[model samples]
Each structure stands twice: as C-alpha cells, then as structure tokens.
Target: MKTALALLVGSVMLAGAADAQEKTIRVSYETPPAHIKSRTIEFFKEELEKTSDGYFKVELYPSAQLLGPSEEVAATARGQIEMSAPYFSYIAPVEPLMNIYQAPLVFDSYEQLWKFLETDEAKALAARLESRNLMPTGYWFENPTRLWGKEPLRTLADVQGKKIRTVPSEILQKAVEAMGAQPTAIPGTELYLALQQGVADGAFTAPNYGLTMKYYEVTEAVTKLDLFLGGYLVLFNKRWYDALPEDRQQQLMDAVAASRAFNEENVQKDLAKVDDDLRAVGQQVIELTPEALAEFRDALAPLYGTLDPQIQAMIEQVRGL
Candidate 1:
C-alpha cells in the first residue's frame, strides 16, 4: 500500500511539472493604446486566460513593440511570434488574394464584409495560409476608409498632381494613380511625419486611425469618401496551434470569434465619434456630392478588371451572398 501511494504521488508530480512547462503564447499588433484594435486584443487576453483556467496565457505586444505592421505576418509565419493581427494589405505580398479586401468600394458596410468572410471563397483563402505554415483564426473589421488631405478632394481632378500615401496594396496604388495622384507606399508609423514634412500631401485611412494617429494635426481636411473597408487577419502559427490539445484549440477559436465581435462593436462606436473628434481638432470634414462620388468610383473601376482572377471570383461569390 505504501508503494502504491508513492507511485500515485509521483504520477501527480509529473503531471504538474508537464502542465507548468506549457509556454505562454505571444501575440503582436501595431495598434497604439488608444486604438480599438489594441482594446480588442486586451479583451482576448483576459477572456482566454479565464476560459482556459490558467492553462493557456497570452502575452500581447502592441504598438509595434514586438513587430512592425509589415513584419507581423512574416514573423508569425516564421514562428518568431505565436500570433499577430495584421491588416490584409500588409499580408497581400504573401497572399496576393488578400488584396481583395482592399479593393475600393467593394464593401458598402461592415455587415457585408463579415458575411463575405464566412463564405466559401474566404475559407479557400484561409486554407492558402497553410502553405506558409500560418493559420488565419478569424478577422476583425477596421472602420471604413476616408481621405485626409491639405486640400479638398471633391473629384478625381482635385487629386491630380498630388502625392498620396497609401498602404502597400497594388489595387490602392493603381486606384490613386488612376485618380491622377502620385501614389506613395508609406508605412502607417511614418505617415504623420511624411505629411508634416511634405513627403506626401495626403493619405487614405479610417477616421479613427486618422484621429488616433494625429493625422488631423498634419492635414487640414478629412473627406467622407468611405471608399473601402479595412480588414485584419488574426493569424496563428500553425505548428504551435496544431500542437495544442483539441479542447484548447476550440477555446482559442472561440476566443478569436468573441474578440472579433468585440472589435466590430468598438469600431462602430469609434466611427460615430470620429467627425466630432476631427472637428474638435480643427479639421474640416467634407461630404462629397453624388456626382463627385460617382466620378471617384468610376476612376477606380479599371482596378476591378485588373485584380487577380481568384480575387475577382471571391468578390463575385461575396456579392452573391
């Protein structure tokens, strides 16, 4: 009986040691503290720890502390980090089809963008991540894209001969050039300095981003263009994810879904407050007339034809939904 008791105690001690050896995952994102993206990640970290009963822990590195926007996807893929939240445009170089999410005027509302993510085509795109040894656990919506400039951009002609900073997406670059602007690929972190120094005269970004990034301080005008909706992929290192127990895997997936919902709610709230915030900061907000809106959309139409066929098919499938 003493031998049996000793054996049982040894077993328990070994199990405890194994459990203690499970490492905490590190997740990275480029969003600053005031951004909803950072808030959503905080929510995930809290909920995941509670749900896992301390068996799983998440270490969040925000504001490019661990990896910059352009490097997040590659870092996650290489397992340098366990996970990252990267804007689709940043990952398009690895997954060119991701550029579809940046296609101007494709999604009229956040609801439509979420619906497309659950579609078959989106799932197929998610599958492509396996090749890079990465997994897209889910996606979060950023606010609708808006134009910020020193001068009013009421029509395509207004943008002619101007330098515009855009995320590194071929579609956006082509669209800006088509509108007669010199398109410059600039990282988000450097945009404010670029604008203030006259390296670029304008930028395309969400209202909340413009406000949080202090774009209003550099530019005098914010145009309500609503040209595109920004989407971010919450990716995980496949090897790390696959090694987790089945129950832990399910918990992570549930956490992702919950975090995404939280992010969506926050974005809606922030966007509602953007105009007032921009106005308070002395930025003029302009609404385009219907004719000007049509002209802006027409200028980007050629992009629809030039996008990858796979992306075009995905767009069609999403529209059908």
Candidate 2:
C-alpha cells in the first residue's frame, strides 16, 4: 500500500513539473508586420523558442489587434496582457522620466544617447516602472523623429498655422507649437484617416513608417528635423516575470540581446530608402537649410526649462558627456 501511495505522489509531481516548463508569452504592439518593432519582436520570438528548446513560446499581436498604444501600458500593468511594446510617450504619464524620450533635440548623437541610457540615473528611472506592476526589461529603438506633411514644410514660415498630429508627450506638443504648427494628439492606428479627413495637416513619423505603414501615400513632403530618438519600451507584467525561474529570466534577456542586430543595422538604411521611395512617388523630401535649422534650434532652446528639474539635470549631465 505504501508503494502505491508513493507512485501516485510521483505522478502528480511530474505533471506539475511539465506545467512549469511551458511558459507562453503574449506580446502586443500597434505596428504592422513591416515595421522594425514587429521585426524585432519576431526575431525575439524565434530566438527565445529556439534557445529554450520550445519550452518558451511567444504569441504576437500586431497592428492593434489586441490593444492600441493608449491602452497598452495600463493593460500590461494590470496584468490584462502579458506584454506590450508601447511608445515611451505613452509610458511617460505613469513614469515621468520616460517623458524625456519624446522631447525633441535632446541628445546630440546616437553614441551620446546610448551612453546616457547606461548611466546610473537612467537605470534608477527605469527601475521605477516595477513599482506600478510594470517591468521594462527590454526596449526597441524606432527611427529618429521627423515631420511629414501634406504640403512643403521647408522652413519655419511654411509650418505656421498647420495642424499637426503628435505623440502623447507635452514637450513634443510644445515643440510643434515652437515650429508654429497646431499640435493634435492622435493614435497611430488612426493617423492615416486623420490625415485623410483633414484632422491633421501634418504628423510626426520615422522613415520606416513612410516605407511600411505607407505614410508616404498620404504625405506630400518629408522634412528632416532629426528630432530625438523615439523608442518603444517592452513592458512586461512584473508579477509574471518575477514568477519565472532564474534561467528562464536570463533566456528572455538573451533573446532580446540577439534580436537587436537587425534594428541596429537597418534603421539608417531605411531612411535612405525612404528618400528615394518618396521622390519616386512624387513627394518632396525637404532638407532644412542652415538658417532654417538655426531658427528651429532657437525656437526649441527655451522649451528645455519646462522639464522636471531632476529629469532636466539628468539630461544636462548627459549632454556634457
């Protein structure tokens, strides 16, 4: 009888162990298949499954199939979703330091920008996400910011009084105002319609958006502003991540590391392709003159004081680096 009891206990334990090994990650984003964010997540899925020997599986929901950008951060925090890659501006209201990501003309170059992210201050700011049940364990950099419009926006005078769609960041809205355009906050899913319906005369986007999402289809011009580097931070439910075994956690991070190579290589290439593609479709690719760039810089200079003092100081410190 004791032998029979031991056999039953062993059967149940084996079942529980099998269950623990099969972890399913559901990741949602608001971009279509061709966007870099989608591509990055696809690579991450492939690497994670392969490295974990199929013990881990990732399910992706793209083009707002599961949740829109505005809903992702709150839903992920509530554990309504396992993962979501929302823009940093969308995360900023809950995590203030994130607001800096949307602020225009901050970091001077990619080297300086990446160096700043490695600093102690940035890590502490990222740590604050966990307090609200969200974990930013990984991130994907989108293309640098630029303005796309229905008409030529080659100079500050040309931008005046135009209605422009912008991100959820207030600093960016101020930047739009500084450029002399009206700022309207619109979700990515609805941007094409917004432009078509004249809800916005112009909008902000990366070169990838013009190529993949077909923003060039609606736009008449692409202005080179070289605004701040925008990003989509992967926010996982903290509870779900903390419950994972240490090995599993490391496996997930390894997958993110492996998936970055494509984005690092292709971001600039996409811009050059976009310039050619836009002209082929008969749209103007506007380059700002030295005088026009100076006007833009002078307009944006005073807006830096609007940041939270701590975030302002952190940015100032990074610029000096």
Model number with the top lDDT: 1
TM-score of each: 0.92, 0.92
Please give me the total number of clashing residue pairs in predicted model 1.
Answer: 0
Candidate 1 residues 158-226, lDDT tens each? 888999989888889998988889999998888989999999989998888878888888898988888
**RMSD to true structure for each model, in Å:** 3.3, 2.6
Show pairs that collide, candidate 2.
none
The runs of at least 3 residues in candidate 2 whose Cα sits more than 4 Å from the true structure, single-residue gaps closed, are 1-22
How high is the lDDT of residue 229 in model 1?
90
Q: State the C-alpha lDDT per candidate.
A: 0.86, 0.82
In Å, residue 166's CA in model 1 sits off its true spot by 0.6
- Clash total of candidate 2: 0
